[model samples]
Target: MSGVEFNRRLESIPVYPAAESYGEDEGLIKLASNETPWGPPPAVIGAIQGQLETLNRYPDPAKSVLRRRIAERSDVPISKVVVGNGSCEILLAAGDALLEPGAEIVYAWPSFSMYPHLAAQSGARAVEVPLANGVHDLEAMAREVNAATRLVLVCNPNNPTATAVGIDEIDAFVASLPRHVAVILDEAYVEFNLLQDPGESIDLLSKHSNLVVLRTFSKVYGLCGLRAGYALGTEEFRLAVDRVRQP
Candidate 1:
C-alpha cells in the first residue's frame, strides 16, 4: 500500500475524555484511579522550592533541570531527553510529530485510549488491535502492523489489569518490528511492574533506534500534581518528538 487510503475514524472523532463528574471540593481519596500515593522525593521538593523564587519568570520552557534529573536517574544521556508539562503532552507531541495525515497508529484496545485519541486529533488513523489472553499478544500485534503503520504502542504491565509479558518476549517483539516504524513502550507504572527487569527498555533502545519509552514522576516519584513526565529514546526520536512541542 502507498500509505493509508482512509482516515475518517480518527480524524473525525468528536469526543474527548473528560471528567464524568466534578464532585466534592477535594474530599475524596480518589482510589477510583491508581496514584502513587507517595509524592515527589524530599530532594525534588527542595528543588521545586528553590525554583519558587523564579515563579514569576517563565519556567525553563525546555525543562532542562527536570530532564537532567530524569536522565541522571534513567541513565540515558541528557541530550536524549525532552520534558513537558505532563506525560500526556509528550505522548500527544509524539502523536503529532510522528503521525502524518494518513499514518496509522497501532495500539491495544483495552490498553490506553489516548493512543487512538491523539491519532484522531492529528488526523491519523487508529489501528486498535484487540488484546489476547489478558496480556499483549505480540504475534497478533505484529500481524496487524502494515507498511502504513507509523507507530506501534506496547503498554507493558498494562493498566487496570496490570499484566506484562516477559522481558525477552518484549525484546523479541521489538526485534520483529520495522526500524522506521516507532515502537513506544508506555512504562508509566514500571515502578510497580514486578514482572520484568526494569532495565529492559533501556537495553532495547541501544539496539532499536525506533524504540520509545515513556516514564513519569507522577507514579514512582509521586508528583502527578506537578505534572512531570518524559519520553525516553535515542536522541533522534526525542528530537522528532520535540519538534511539535510549540503551541
Candidate 2:
C-alpha cells in the first residue's frame, strides 16, 4: 500500500449510487440513466466522424463555436454561456466556485444525488429539504436559505420522480431569495418535460442575475458519450465557474 491519505472530508460524503449495469444483455431495455431510446441523428454522427481526422489536435478551449450556437438558440449573449464536459461538470464547477466551509447549499432531498456530494466535496453544509409529493418543495427550500446559504440547486423535471416545478413558482422562489445566493436550475431532462414549457426557465435569467440555467445534450439529444453541456447566466457568473473548469 502507498499509505496515501485522501481528503478526510470524503469520509462524510456518501458514494454516488450509479445505476447497476447489465453487461451484454441482449434485448434488454434500460431506463435508469435516462438515455434516449434512439441513437443520435445521422447528421450529428457525420459531424463527429468528420472531425476524426483532427483528433491529434485539442478542441477549442473556449468552445466558441458551440457556445455561440447555444447562445443564439437560448437567446442569451455568448459571454453568458459556459460549456462543460457535461451538465454534471458544470454542477461540480459551480460548487467549487461558489461553495466553501461555513457556506450552505440547499436542494430538495431525494432529488439528484450529486447535490449532497457537491456540498460535501466543497466543505459546505447541505440543507436538503424533503420533496413534497415527489417534487421539489420550493417554499421549504426558500425558507432553508439563510445568510450562510451560497448556492441553491433546483433540478426541474427532477431525477427519479420526473416532476417539475412551474415557471411562476420558480420566478417567485428566485424573487424570495437574497441576491447573494446563486441559484442553479439543472434542467437535465427538460426536453422530456411535457407538463410545462421548458423554455420559460431561460427567461428568468434576465430578471435574476443570480440565477443560472444548465442544459445537456446527453438526454434527449442522445449524446451521453460526447458529454456536452452548458450553463447560461450573467458574464460574471460564467467567468467565476470558467476559472475552475479544466483546460
Candidate 3:
C-alpha cells in the first residue's frame, strides 16, 4: 500500500531546532535563539502599551503605517516596501513568487540554513555556492546562475559566521546576473556592521532593478516579539512578493 504523498522535499528538509523552556530553578540558559539580553527601550514599550486598546482589532491590511515609516527610513518609495511578520516571511514570499519545479535558487552555504529549506518548499532546486573563507563567494555564485535561475539570496554579514561581502563586491555580482533572476540581500544583521563601515547596497538599488534588501526589527530594535520586518525593492518586485503575502 502506498502512503499519502506530499511534496517530496518536505521529507528531507531540516527542522529548525527550537529552544526548550526551563523552570525558574533549573538554571538552564537558553542559547539556541539569538534573543537580546535586554528588553526594548522605554519608548518602545510605551508605544506598544498604547496599542493595547486595538488588541482585538485586526492589523491594517496594507500595513500602511509601518510601510511608510520603513520607506522613509530606507529612502525608497512607500510602494516599494512590503512589511511582514519578519524578514523570513518576506523570504517566503520571494520563494512563492519566484520558485517552482525545475527552477533554481542560488545562495552561499555556511550561511542561513533557511535558504535551502525555502527553495525546497517552493519546489525549486537549491544551488549552494560554497563560501570563500566564511564569506559569500559572489563570483562563484554568479557563475552558477543560468536561464532557469529565478532567485538568489545573499545574506550580508552572513549568519553564524558573521562575515560580510563589501558593497563593490555585491554591486559587481548583481550586475553579472541575468535580469530574469531576482536577488534578495538579507540584511537582518546589518545594524551591527553599520557601526564601522555602513554598506551601500541599499543606495545602489536604484541602479539594480532586480535587487531586494531585507531588514528586521528583531535584532537591533529588540522587537522579535512583535515580528516586524520589511523588504525594499522595485515596486514591481514588491507587488510580486505581495501577491503571495497574506492580506
Per-model TM-score versus the true fold: 0.87, 0.94, 0.93
lDDT of 1 by residue, 4-77 (tens): 67656544665653444556556646664467666678997898898788878876777787789888987889
Single out the weakest 10-residue window by summed lDDT for candidate 2: 16-25
**Candidate 2 lDDT score at position 178:** 100
Model 2 CA lDDT for position 69: 98
TM-score of candidate 1 relative to the true fold: 0.87
Candidate 3 lDDT score relative to the true structure: 0.86
State the lDDT of candidate 3 residue by residue for 120-159, as single tens digits: 7888888999999888889899999999999999998789
* Residue 66 in model 3: lDDT: 86
Assess each prediction's global lDDT (C-alpha) against the native. Answer: 0.80, 0.90, 0.86
lDDT of 2: 0.90
Pairs that collide in candidate 1 are none
lDDT of 1 at 156: 79
Flag the better candidate by TM-score, 1 or 2: 2
